[model samples]
Target chain A: MARSRNHEQWTSPPPFTQEEYVDSRIYSDQDIFEEELEKIFKKSWIPVCHESELPEPYDFRTTTIAKEPIILTRAKDGKVRAFLNVCPHRGNMLERAPSGSFLDGSPSGNPRHITCMFHAWQFDMKGRCVYISRQEEGYQDRLKKSQMGLRELKCEVYFGGFVWVTLNDQIDMTVEEWSAGSLEVLKPSLDEEPLEVFHYHKAIIPCNYKLWHDTNCEFYHDYLHYHNRITGFNDAYFARKNTGFDNGHINVGSFEVQYDNYEGSHSREEISFPHLPPNHWYMIDMFPGVNFNLRGSSLRCDIMTPLGPNEVMIEFRGLGLKNDDAVTRRSRIDHHNSIWGPFGRNLHEDLLAVTGQGSAMNPRAENRQILHGRHENETIHDENGMRHFYEEWGRWMDRMPSNPDKPFVERTTATSATG
Target chain B: MSNADAVRDSIYRSCMYKDDMKWQEWLDLCDEDFQYSITAYSPEIRNDMIYLSGDREEMRGMMKMLPKHNTDHSPLKRHCSVYAVDLEDDGSMATAVSSVVVYQTQLDGINSHVDAGESKVFLVGRYFDKFRISDGVAKFVEREVKLDTRKLDKGSHYPI
Candidate 1:
């Protein structure tokens, strides 16, 4: 094979048509990234944190959605609620720490209230504004404490106690309806017992958030993981189907992993999750990018906070049964760390690949065609998961994936030059 | 040499061998029952996490398979400061505490022209180590790396 010259490279058409390829601009364009924050991220129900993270009545955790700071707090009545972290007085951020309990009093504020350190304003756990600095002295009649409540977002704890929050109050669907049954595959295992997070880490990678989600959506890149290749390349693995659901979610069917095939690794059957078959693995890739993966002994979840067109912050959590004994918890942690930990065998490899993609596809770099063209009856190696995700993305953005400058046109069939 | 001197020498050698990618030399300094682990505390979940851990035999097997994996081949240089070394009354064991900062020079096969030659601090952590000493020779029995830096960018295939 010979390399193409500049003119030939520019003029040659790919072996696949619009449905099978997407313009790289969607991953690197600044304006398109801003539009995605408005149309896709803010409007969708996102799993921000697990309910176990805020176990106590006054426990709170802070996070961001589409760059807007959000705080989740458990009220005195045993309910978890979400609100904009910004304060109503002077728009100061209410909470700065990642997580803590509001039961303790601060130097300038009372106990059991979310306090704004800026001007000594405070709100109750239920987002009711309870105090303002010198309330009766400063515009007493004009600004009543009752009307100064925090801007509360729609929050629901569901699907195995994950705290789901949506910025759009007009959103038509609940978290269950939005999932479209994509989470049903792991429901038996996850919902059977209360899970507690045992490991947590975050990586601010230089890549579009979707690229990380794409890695979770398909398994063709398993060759990059020598451990996975050795332990999971059997016929049963190849036959696992990639099933796409409505609203762009996809589920990869379960298959037993042969852990004994890899040297120094043993079967995790003895510590398998509740109701899940021994050594089996299941994955649920939620649309616009959150991944829930259960591999027999432990469950791992990846949540993305998109920073820009070329950067994303990914938070990874590993969880196990809340009532595990010391020995069982140790084994569960070992199993979880061996594969998905920050210094694990597989997580770094995926980060390396996506960062490489980010470097090549930086903003203002040349636009190129990225192929999602492989056709394998929607099996493990097929590209159907990404295809389905992009379809939903295009619908929300109202722009074609193949050419962002053009309007989106729905396609009913796969029409590739080679197929 | 004194027991503290021997333990310090062994700790320095471990850093040098790992930075140079001399896996065999590093393993040779480890005792037969050596255990290694990397740990960090996450404020997001208010929990301590064990990121990686293994025994001597497991480390040997993982080192043997490193060549076949897709890794960030950037070279790491560990800067270590041995703060203290305390020897047991019987002189059969020693414990050392050190602070370490690892710097990674970006040299990947996919030289993207943007980050190819830049060097950056990759990790900031403290090493809490235990050693077994016999005949003035110290060997690592346990090394627990507690990292203060949680955002490990692209992370390393090998231990810090």
Candidate 2:
């Protein structure tokens, strides 16, 4: 084919249906990004942190969902709770650190209480206001402690002890319902024994959060990962299915990785999770950006926070069985870090690609068509994972993905199986 | 040169070889059983984590495979300052502490038009290095990179 003229270059569309491509504006437009946070992220169930992260009473972790600060604590009753990390008095952020224990007293806080450094307000692990400086003298019974308690959010600890929270108080679905069985494939392995996080790191990538999730959704990009290409391109790998679930979740079926195919790489079979076949891998990409990947020996969870339309902060956690002996734990860490760590063989390459995409689709850049056109019987190389996700995204935003100017219309074809 | 100076020289040579992407030259400065690791303490998880670790042979294999993988070809210049060297009584072994600040020059890819020739700090860390001196020749036995910067943007295909 001859090279196109300038007008044709700008006007021509790819020879594919609307479902096969989405407008680049969905990734680079500030207005669409903010509306996504409100319509999709805020209303969806998000895994804030793992329950094991706050094992002891008064242990707390602070995070955000759709930019609303949240604090999760292990209360005296041994239940995990989530609340807005704001001092009701003046809306000051209550916890400044990423994580800590409230058991020790600070200069401005009492033992076993969440403290607001701005005004010295204190709340218990359950988020009940325990102390307020000069409450009776200043307000004079106008604001009681009962009415000043922290705003509690809906929280649940399930599906392998992840603490799932939602900013919407009236969300209709439970965490299980939200997952829609996307996690069933690895349920036995993940729930067989308690898990403990052995590694934690985060990177602020210059890319939209969905782009990172897109990386997780499909295995076609394995071409970009030499490690995966060398070890995972066998017939079994190509035959593995991409199963889409409701609420934008997708699962890549298990496939045995030939770990020893690569030079200096060792088989992870010996330390495979309980009930899991040696050398097998399974992955689940949850809606609005969360990934749970179970390689033979370790479980890696990626939680994304959209800092802006063109930037995202991804927290990476690697977990092993809590009862792992020192030697076993060391081996698990090695297996995890070998592929997924910040300096890992594969993750840096993924980050590099996404950052490239981000640079090309910055807010000022002209909108272009981003393709998702491949079709391969819903197998590993199929693009249905992303197509299904955008279908749901269009529903939530009530806008067509290919043409954001038009309202969303449901397609009649059954591109995905119901989870 | 003094035994301590020899060990310091070995450390400096390793940095230069790494900056030049001369993997074999860098490996030549290490002992047969040398261990290399990049570690950091994450306040988020309240734990010390190792991001990368390998023995000499494993390191060699990884470096050999670098060409097959997609990597950022931007050049890295490591500025290292050896702060202290403690020589053992026999002068056969020494331990050195140094501060490292790595700067990367963006020279390739899309941003080159705007960022080419511009240098940005890539990493800040301390190196705890141990060496074994044989006949006045020092080779690294172990090097632990304890990094202060945890949020490595886009990270690196090679070790820091």
Candidate 3:
């Protein structure tokens, strides 16, 4: 925590080991940010949207991943697909709105197509170029519509209500393989219980994307959130487990968070997803930036995409069952909004703390060490998930982090150093 | 004042209480059955979106705990223009539709020279409100803040 004038304190020989600390350079360095963008975000299976978002054929949702425009669509054949949302014909932008449907031009008299508002070039849901204007009169012999098609990305819809996309084609791994055993822990809720996104909102924070993920993995920051302190620090809360999966994914399974412990809040019912016991608090940090969380009566998914080195855009969604009655749905919405919304009891504080951390780390003037080495047999209090994340980050960047400067090194005095 | 005039005046006063950060005064204007929600639709995801929904008790608890929470200090001034006020045929409740434009001024650390002097438009929305008038005084029964803008900056804590 000390930014002493002596860089010696940073490189000091005998503080804590690499297990508990990460180099601050990862947060501040521009070159590292660029490397992370190319190596990690471009290759990871980023969560795009829920399948229900585009339930009808030819429906599409547009978003940006790592600063590149992307479109996820349910094609006419009833299969979902992903493509780069750019017009092939003059390289113009496509789909200005966040989402829309391909109209059957036959209504007015034309073929059905995902029409690009620019230059009127139309593409089918399968990324095929269907029509080009003034084709017969000019350049008919030179230009062929069949020869050009929109660039496609690897898209997969898993058992959970999420759509995952990746940019790299060289990799042969499937989304299920990448997320091995991660959804198994969620099967009782995600697999059997049907769900749909009930609420959607987005906000932009002026900070690196990873800063937001830190708020998810590190449970010690609960002290920063007063409302969480009231209902989250009980004995049952600490007796939890964090399971680390391959490829930087980790799931934290904890006992029920008794929201009823707080004065005005009420107890939860058995209306949680299929087979999920009341008060169950489960969360998955789906490596890179997609997160799925089910707390008591409601579920929320948050996915982030980097806008720049110092800014990130976060899309938040709250989910509930498709057939929930009015009472159950209201309870779900109430529970979700209380903890996950922009004005939630905890999210506002989380955003503030992360943005503040980003601002403090944005300046490279000081050498900072982020201490994540807390261990309580991998309880909710453990920082092992963070350690897992950075190890993957280090593998991608091909260099040891500069803050802690060592990944596997041990500092036996870590307990005292935390003092 | 007449009942309609009282309803309009109460609406203006409610906006004043919110703008001035007078939480207790604002709460006093609400009936026991009052409900407040901030809602918007995202064409990106779903047809109906509920950003924040709470009843009178939940709001009471929130206001009680607000001072202890780490909330944004940036002040917001809501500019409101009442468009239509209509009393129901049965006279049980009255409704008012006011177009609201909220400007957020960065006073603390997050607002630097880039956003120092100008109070930026934080959100543009309409307040669809229901009131119960008794003896020419109006008490808020329900207010649904249907926001047209979905993207928010870092610092919005209060209901818009």
Please report the candidate that would top DockQ against the real structure: 2
Q: Can you tell me the CAPRI class of model 3?
A: medium
**TM-score of each prediction:** 0.97, 0.97, 0.92
Instruction: Give the Cα lDDT of each candidate.
Output: 0.90, 0.90, 0.78
lDDT of each residue in A227-304, candidate 1, tens digit only: 899999989999998888889899999899999998889999999888899999999999888999999799999999
Write the number of the candidate with greater lDDT, choosing between 1 and 3: 1
The two-chain DockQ for each candidate, comma-separated, is 0.71, 0.73, 0.64
Q: For model 2, how does the per-residue alpha-carbon lDDT over A13-94 read when each residue is reduced to its tens digit?
A: 6789998899988998899999999998899999988888888999999999999999999998999999999999989999
